[model samples]
Target: MRPALRTRRACRKLATALMASTVMLAGCASAQPAGTQAPASVSARPSPEATGPVAAVYKDLVYRSIDGTDLHLDLYTSAHANGQPSPVLVYFHGGAWARGQRPESWRGYSRFLQRGYAVITVQYRLAGEAQAPAAVQDARCVLHWIGANADRYGFDVDRIVAHGTSAGGHLALMASYLEAADGLDTPDCEGVPRVAAVLDFYGPTNLAQPYNGAASGRHPSVVRWVGDGPGAHDMDVRMSPLTYVGPDVPPTMIVHGDSDDVVTIDQSRELYAALQRVEVPTDMVIVPGGGHGKFPDAEKARVAGEVDRFLTTIGLP
Candidate 1:
């Protein structure tokens, strides 16, 4: 058997063992109500040891500095490296793009380390700090940072995968699909590397649409991020992932819950249809009774399996 296949099988077995132990997998938090705040638990940072063992862990590494503020990321390399550089899983945490810490759920992502993949969780400006293209720009800068530091970190730049849930998912899509021509790349870290694949978990695709329904009005979080200024609608169009969909975009896997009231499954459906129209390699997994990111243990396990298969199909290292 090929080495990659062997590594995949081993990861699958590890996942099985973790499931049997009733570990709760990491997923996005449900959308906070329009007038509410994210729970304190969601905003709290995880301790360094929470991520478990890895060959190395670099915490709070500054990836970008803008307007007197510095953005950070945490890197966790696999302990199983065999001299070959490892594929990278670049993770963006989700909290309606307003709240949530980068290290919110490191334990849940430890599986990637066990599978010989380097993992990175990023911190970007939130709705309160900056809006719309700001987070998007930071996301692109992260890719550039990875590309610049690949050799030092033993990362395989050719196999970098972007993964995120909810608002983070939107950032992942924007970062992976948008090119230098998009003008979202930061001047300091211009020129993002092509992402190998994208994993979007119930992220909003079209920001122009009213959240939930026309009667529901726009989602407050989105309004906070996009602002209700004179150019709000235009910004909505420019910031939308749907606006940039094209055949050259990386292979993408979308996982959504049919019953999701937060982001609505239709968002993923529309993205899937658009990708299909453009002939991009794409897959969608609709969880029957899943709501937002609150999938049941069984469903989460199934989704993990599907993710593994998708990455394998795309030839991720």
Candidate 2:
């Protein structure tokens, strides 16, 4: 059953408290403040070419630039073998919409590349640059760019998938669910951008109901991303992927921890129920002892296997 509309107010309050607590939930860390110097080791690295049957990577390829800041992505492809366009998995990094970088290493994605998929990890505007919708806008822009440049990149645009963790999960769903919505007014090349599926990892589905028992207070980070101004309420609704769920949403696979303390398990439950009500093909995997993004190696492998199976079930490459 669908959640009651009254849950929206409760969930919104939870979002605020969660933001103020500084709890360091996986993927929900506070944004890196400007001028806050970091150890030199954290910077993004350069891309590398494929040596064998592995992947050839194009790093820091600029997708769009706005307000003097450029958004970039890393494209990883298996060595050109049969002149075939590879299936794509566009990755969005997680950091509570505030911090995080694109894939600098194939630490977790080697399987996909080995399986002949091209993976594009993207960087988008954070709360430090703008706010809620800016990241979402950047997401749309990247998809459009990927579609427009697919031929040149040897990517199969029709079989694209959007995958993300935590906040990135939220953005991935937004990119897919809001495909028909009016996009930001950024200059863009012509192409239809669509996602065949969404892979969500513990992302908050309903901003209003991030968790139960959230104190009646506003979270500073939430305020920063969505703004606490007069338009904030509307902005929250605008940025939430739940507001856009419909029959047309693509196939979705969600993996969340049952013990997740940061975002709560109910978020995924509600989302899964909602998708089922709409009759969209959907699957949900609940990691028994998982918390936030913490899953053991075997569990991680299980999730990876599930992802591959989901993609295949959906008729994707």
Candidate 3:
């Protein structure tokens, strides 16, 4: 049976309490302050060529500009739109928060397009250029941008879903879970509606813990993104998606590989437990021998089927 959803007011109250404890949990360490950033000046225009199953493609649409840097996202509208608003999947790429670009291959997402969902793949600041919360801020900004321009793009604002893999999965969870009260949203992009759902694939839920716990020591990529300082550990706690788990968060589905070494299956387990405690509708799919994202072809097919069923169950279909 589906769990009873909590009222928004109740969820916010719980979220407020969770956020309030940051000071006590990480003594003397505060979250990184939001930077002064502006909306992107570039307007999105359609590409000259339309591709298979995609009605139109808009590339390099600037979403946010921070300190002279312009962040971009690619928009692909489905050929099946047929003059109706399309459900959206806002995707973030995973690179351990340090590397990785917006997706170049459309094979994985082509099904969504064929099924009439518009897909937006975003690009954000990496750890090489910024630290904790910067990427999170960028992720939130992309949602705001989508919300602000939904009519212009024929997007269904109410059905926007956050989907990402690895580090990107972490961003998707952060973008979907954190509210304006958390002070993580960019000033210019505040008040965007919350995501309808979240799809997290092997994303790290706890930044405070070592990579895969004691089994793998510390991960350099996580250390780089969280930074090194007196407040570093505090920032780790602040950056963790696990920190923001509350009843108000969107319905979520997590997929992880039990045999993965890069990001342990325990991460997803903890998130599932937290969500269940809060009575949020959530699901977890663990592949028996999946490694990171390198699932065998059969396993990949099974996971894809599971994802499709989950999405349909959540009204995305």
Q: Highest lDDT, which number?
A: 3
lDDT of 3 by residue, 75-145 (tens): 88889988999999899999999999998645569888888899999998888777776788889889988
- lDDT (10s digit) by residue, model 1, range 177-262: 87775544545766678999999999998887766454435677777787775556556665678777777789999999999988
Q: 1 or 2: which has the higher lDDT?
A: 1
lDDT of each: 0.75, 0.71, 0.79
**Clashes, model 1:** 0
Model 3 misplacement above 4 A: 1-49, 211-218
Please provide, for model 2 over 200-254, each residue's C-alpha lDDT reduced to its tens digit, 9 standing for 90 to 100.
9998787754333435244445666776555455456556677666677889999
Best by TM-score: 3
Tell me the TM-score of each prediction against the true structure: 0.82, 0.81, 0.86
Off by over 4 Å in 2: 1-49, 52-55, 183-190, 210-220
TM-score preference between candidates 1 and 2, better one:
1
Better of 2 and 3 by lDDT: 3
